[model samples]
Target: MIRDGERVTLGDTAVTAHATPGHTMGSMSWSWRACQAMTCKAIVFAASLNPVSSDGYRYTAAASRPIVAGFRHSYRVMQSLPCDLLITAHADQDGATDRFRTAPGACRALAASSRTKLAARLRADGPAR
Candidate 1:
């Protein structure tokens, strides 16, 4: 298994792994630097941060405590990533397809968006146990 924070080498690129266990217990994110001629860009492939659950699953359930905590941690991890390009597991989740320019704050914005989604779900479904 690829452990969190481990760097895997691929050709001349080094992809660093990040554990972003929101969508699942073993969800992962990756970051790497890519260059073209002269300039290089920091790119991050963030994992799906959605607060999805199976039918009848409850975020407030005792067994879901770790999953809920994972969501929160995933948000923090996404926000802290330093990258010129941000790619999410779900293209629509972070607006990666419609972006025409690089936004330094994209990672932060993506994290905020995911956090908002979780908040909405928690409010609409169940606040707490």
Candidate 2:
């Protein structure tokens, strides 16, 4: 959940979380202030980051519900964020930096469109059903 008024102190930078649930009960994504602009940066999923898991492993599908949901909500937030760059915890699925080397407006539009496709697949495939 987006901790209202709670400033995230990370070393020299302080970031803020914007609530973006749907992946789980408390999925939160972060935004940082950068060079006179407020930008959406790294998004840490609560479920994936959580220490406890049913199978006693690290990040798994069940633990990633919030991560998935974070993406859905992030897609919406990205539209409004003045994001010039996009970062992920890892780059296994969403391509490389070459994918987002466009204007902020274009990037936002592209992300939103991609999310629509993912949503459609999720509904049709039932998350591996």
Best model per lDDT: 1
Identify the runs in model 1 with alpha carbons over 4 angstroms from their true place: 94-101
Q: Tell me the tens digit of each residue's lDDT in model 1 across 40-89.
A: 99898888888877787777778888988998988888878887998777
Task: Report how far residue 92 has shifted in candidate 2, in Å.
Answer: 3.0
Give the C-alpha miss distance for residue 117 in model 2, angstroms.
Answer: 2.8
Candidate 1, residue 41: how far the Cα is off, in Å: 0.6
The ten-residue window of minimal lDDT in model 1 covers 93-102
Whole-model lDDT, model 2:
0.48
Candidate 2 pairs with clashing backbones: 23-69
RMSD of candidate 2 to the truth, in angstroms, is 7.7
